[model samples]
Target chain A: MIENVTLDISGERFQVFYRLRCEAQDVEAFARHICVEQTIEFPAELIGDDDIRRHVMGQVVSLAPLDDHSWRVVISYAVEITGFSLTQTMNVIFGNVSLMPGVRVDRLEFPDSFLSRFKGPRFGLQGLRDLVGEKHQQLYCSALKPMGLSADQLAQQAYQLALGEFHFIKDDHGLADQPFAPFRERVSRCVEQVAKANQQTGGSSRYVVSLNSPAEQIVEDAIWAKEQGVGGLLVPPGIVGFDMMRRLADDDRIGLPILCHPSHLGSYVASPDNGLSFYALFGQLARLAGADVSIYPNFGGRFSFTRDQCLEIVKGCTDPMAILKPIVASPGGGMNFSNVQDMVDAYGKDIMFLIGGALHKGDATVPENCRAFKAQVAALLRR
Target chain B: MIENVTLDISGERFQVFYRLRCEAQDVEAFARHICVEQTIEFPAELIGDDDIRRHVMGQVVSLAPLDDHSWRVVISYAVEITGFSLTQTMNVIFGNVSLMPGVRVDRLEFPDSFLSRFKGPRFGLQGLRDLVGEKHQQLYCSALKPMGLSADQLAQQAYQLALGEFHFIKDDHGLADQPFAPFRERVSRCVEQVAKANQQTGGSSRYVVSLNSPAEQIVEDAIWAKEQGVGGLLVPPGIVGFDMMRRLADDDRIGLPILCHPSHLGSYVASPDNGLSFYALFGQLARLAGADVSIYPNFGGRFSFTRDQCLEIVKGCTDPMAILKPIVASPGGGMNFSNVQDMVDAYGKDIMFLIGGALHKGDATVPENCRAFKAQVAALLRR
Candidate 1:
């Protein structure tokens, strides 16, 4: 994903490929606008220091017009500028520039120095595969939904799904600390139920709760949930903010495979020519911030991620970065039982098929649906 | 801003007016999609409980077609669905719904029960005006910029600006805990300089620093900064998140005016037909999340908030919302001395004139520029 130009520049730097929407004549100026806007944020002429100008500011390393409406402008900034903080890294990447039009982050090239600062994916693709003992086989995931369900109802669904051998049973993002099914009660009952089902079936099914608690309690709850035997976390980077998700992922004690949910992040990828490229957000950012399974809307849903965009997200997840491991691309929005072959053909086996609402369809019950999904996918894997 | 229709709904409900872009014939279905999608993400037929349908689920209160492509659809949900927390409110408002296209959050209606749950702005418009003893005067604010400055250099700039009687001086959002000028050093020196200036000129120029730290350290840093004598907090909700900002504002001990910076929030407003309305993000969300001073790009800046959009933000800041206090509209990006009267004409006097880099221009020194800007604005105020 990062075909970075070997820039003859000083010190450690990170490269950001910006797709600048500007005319042919305006490329250099527009690229310069990014250089200043992202760094110093002051008029270049007014910044009197030489080192600040040369070392601290962003440098436009490459610029090429992509047709008439846009140009690919790659800019490099000093790694120290970020202070190695995840939020500040975000502030440098898209911060103030997000407010302006005609620019979207295309790709990022991070040096190991910058990349090492983040604990990218504690339990990546291989870890997830090993957890389910489906190293080479396709993995299946589903959400417990129709949210006003009590803890007992959700726990029953979790037990049924886990018993039927779902690799991952996650809470619907809507099921937060709502009064109907409080986070503590739901996680407690479901984790217990999942353990019971895994014991009975000898299946390595994991119960993942949405760590969608308020900022104050999230970290504590993550620790508590891990202690309470919850297998993983359904971290909604959008609702909780990506940095908070990163914090949860990076913490050593609460190590868990994060299923990165694309909740509020739709804004970042909604605009075609602004915010960030789909790969940059769902793929690169998610993997870089520590999503073992980066969940996004599949192509066919009312949620509109094109087939090409979905492919790009897959590419983003699997792209080789120094020590950052490859992650599972969990495509969810409108997955159905019949489309398993199509999805497998498109994304290959490096995906955790997230069949949500569709799993509740047909005359089959939840357990039957899960077993049926697994049977069909297992058959396909055998072939 | 909330024009609620008196509905015979059974619970304490909050309303969200969704702008649905769809074919006229498909309005009801698209509206129904929002009702299910926002709350119960499962199929309506599958939800077996009656109370969940009648109480917990989102109801389509009204739907009216807007032209050929868009419809204004209003939906109400149980207030308890949010759990009365800031982040959960955001989740319920724009969680998974944000991922889907053809719908944008137009306006929000909150009942007194829900609105009272939030602390709102600790120091709203009157509190900020009271900070400078300028209740009747149009307030002026500025940002310290060109980031790579040493603590001493930034402190000197802060001293000059405050000495010249600018009501507030804030750190540039770019000025985080970068090695060049660490957060603690910068905040300490700037706050000291501003205090010295206040002593010399009998002015109340508060030094505000950006509370843009990593999630783990943000709250601690906020409390530390306040205890270290920093007058106000510039919270980039896009970085620290709105909920985190609300937490800071709501905390009784570290009570400081919050200057909400729209750093990474541009994506939410960039797409014309997706994400959220300008007022919803900058205005309503800012106020509801407890931003005492909501800063945004003024029109005529390269930053693309139009004149109309800027006006809407001002309306959002000043709009009456139950017991929630109104906030000051800080019009920023590309503000120049010559445009003071023009900005005054448009946004009126309740504005915090956020003059950034332009203050460094012309024959005048920084202190001289500040004095001259105040003089001109004071004359306009007198007139």
Candidate 2:
């Protein structure tokens, strides 16, 4: 009888242990129910009472309680599942429990056989730092936005921001295949402008175009962006399925780091007790789904998320799991140059400081404004 | 200049009319900025200053403010369009606004060119009532279980509940494709069992299987279920795209009323002033997305949705919009026979009262329990 469940909680991984203290007569039945209920939502009658009794799968190896009341329990069942994907494993663990009210999931554990094939993060902390040429400093990030712009106009903004030496510039999540600016034309122009800027500044500022095309267009867009020399992509995992992210990350030809945008995803993690923890959703899940950078609304922004929530998100991104990925926490919305020092102090050097609108609002010319914003970011890191 | 920006604000269509309140000096610039910002996200320089100036074309017809803060402003402009589809139209209105902070959407007025093709709901309120053979009575609903059930076991449960004559029996959202109980087998068994029970009792106990399959699989699943004589389907619009629901609703061959599940969708309407309003999301959008029934967590249930929020959802469903559809608001989670009277008084006849878990715990067997539950609902509706 296995009784423990192990889950990778957002901030840190913990080996959670549990002991199911049930009536002696119901102990074995309870153990079997947990084993099946954790992974699949199949009813007890479906598997037959006799078969459940035979399983006798009930021993707790570890139990960890999350900030939420739910405890992550790791239990080993005698049943063998072969050739199933990680998603299948996840479905097996908590598919049924998700439906039951008050049944909180703490963590999940995989045997070495399943874990070996599970690619955590392709280009992690050091890998991303090496790609961006930022070794122990916070990266500066911005978004090219206000959608109705033409391809040429979007490119110019990208060029200005890149030349100004913003480490990362991504398309606003709203910038999809709109008639005003088709995706290909927009990506081509933006990438070209960024390349020219890189040539002039000797800075490795990367433009991450939003890849919000349908499933069929996802691979094509990624491949096309790589061909056009775009550095990365901004993907909304909530809109495009999680599997799409995995496919993009696995594509060696499309080697650009994937920045996850949490646009329509707030519903899943918005509740304090229900849904998922912000860190688990944006950090662990995003990382596991293969995000090199995860962008969320900064605290004190228009969004309702608090400062502590933002910190927890950062912790989830940087904290150690089975694999350590330096997930650049790009928090945007109402961020400004004045707040750079405070952001640095709050998130430390291992973060991507994202600011938008404010950089373009001042009377300063584009290049001057860009340079000023970059300077402020650099100054904050020095502090 | 087009004055009206048509929007599908979570399924509630609003034709926004707003006057260009910018100064004469800034009107053209503002118009161009709005276009570029809403459509392309291009900077001013990238577009030739003259081209940008020329693109600021608008002819104001009339402007009026609604009872809401929103104003109805009409303008006409030669807007460059990339594609024209239901999906694209939705994108054109709300896509860019999603990025903008504090930009309250006004109203939407659509030209016949766009509006003519949209068939709001095929079998809305009256159609659903006719099918169920109840003109002015609340429907009783319940979910099957936590999952892990075998086909036979699920069928047995369905038989027991259907024999009891529950108006609607649905698959739990968590019951997706799994090895433990495959979707097709489970659907086939449950449908057959329910049909047998219906034959015996001559009751309208419809079985709504969860149809949260991928987009491609959606049509096939619906068609197959229809062929097998299943009554309806359960769709999670949040998990599956909203467009998919529209597609399913548009299909005549697979004509079945859809029950919209708020599975991974709470985040969008969870915050008070952040995402779409709850009524807007669960009621209007779900109905627009072609749901005959919409399910939300009842207040005092396992979820945190408030009583006011629940009522708003009901109002959104039954409200007389451009086209009135009878959207049956089905609230579940921890509801029991004891609360049937309160549920009826709160939601009224145009509702689907959902209760689960509690039925199985009663001393009365499945059939007797279901009969008593129905009697309770019937007694409440008589008032």
Cα lDDT tens digits for candidate 1, A1-383? 00111222348999999998877888898888888988888878876547777777899999887878988899999988787887888889999889988889989999987798787888788988888898787788989877777888889889989987899999987878887788999999999999999999988889999877877888999999999998899987776778888888989889888999888888888877888888888889888888898998898876888889999999999898778899989899778876888787788777889888877777877788888887887788678
Per-prediction backbone clash count: 1, 72
**What would the per-residue lDDT of candidate 2 be over residues B1-383, giving only the tens digit for each residue?**
11122321111222433334323444444434444444434344543434333433233445554334333344433323323343444444444334333223233454444444456566776787788776777777777764445666767888988888887788766566645567788889999999999899898888888876643356788899888878888876665556566667778998888888775565455433234566667876677667888888888765567789789888878876665465778888768777777777787777787877777764688788877877777776676
Q: For all the predictions, what are the DockQ values?
A: 0.50, 0.13
Q: After superposition, how far is residue B115 of candidate 2 from its true place, in Å?
A: 6.5
Per-prediction fnat: 0.71, 0.13
Local accuracy of candidate 1 as per-residue lDDT tens digits, B98-128? 8877779988889987798787998899988
| Tens-digit per-residue lDDT, A192-252, candidate 2 | 8998999999989898988776543567888998998888888776666554576678678
The model with the greatest lDDT is 1
Reference-based TM-score of each model: 0.96, 0.70
| Chain A TM-scores, candidates in order | 0.95, 0.82
Q: Rate the local accuracy (lDDT) of all candidates.
A: 0.85, 0.63
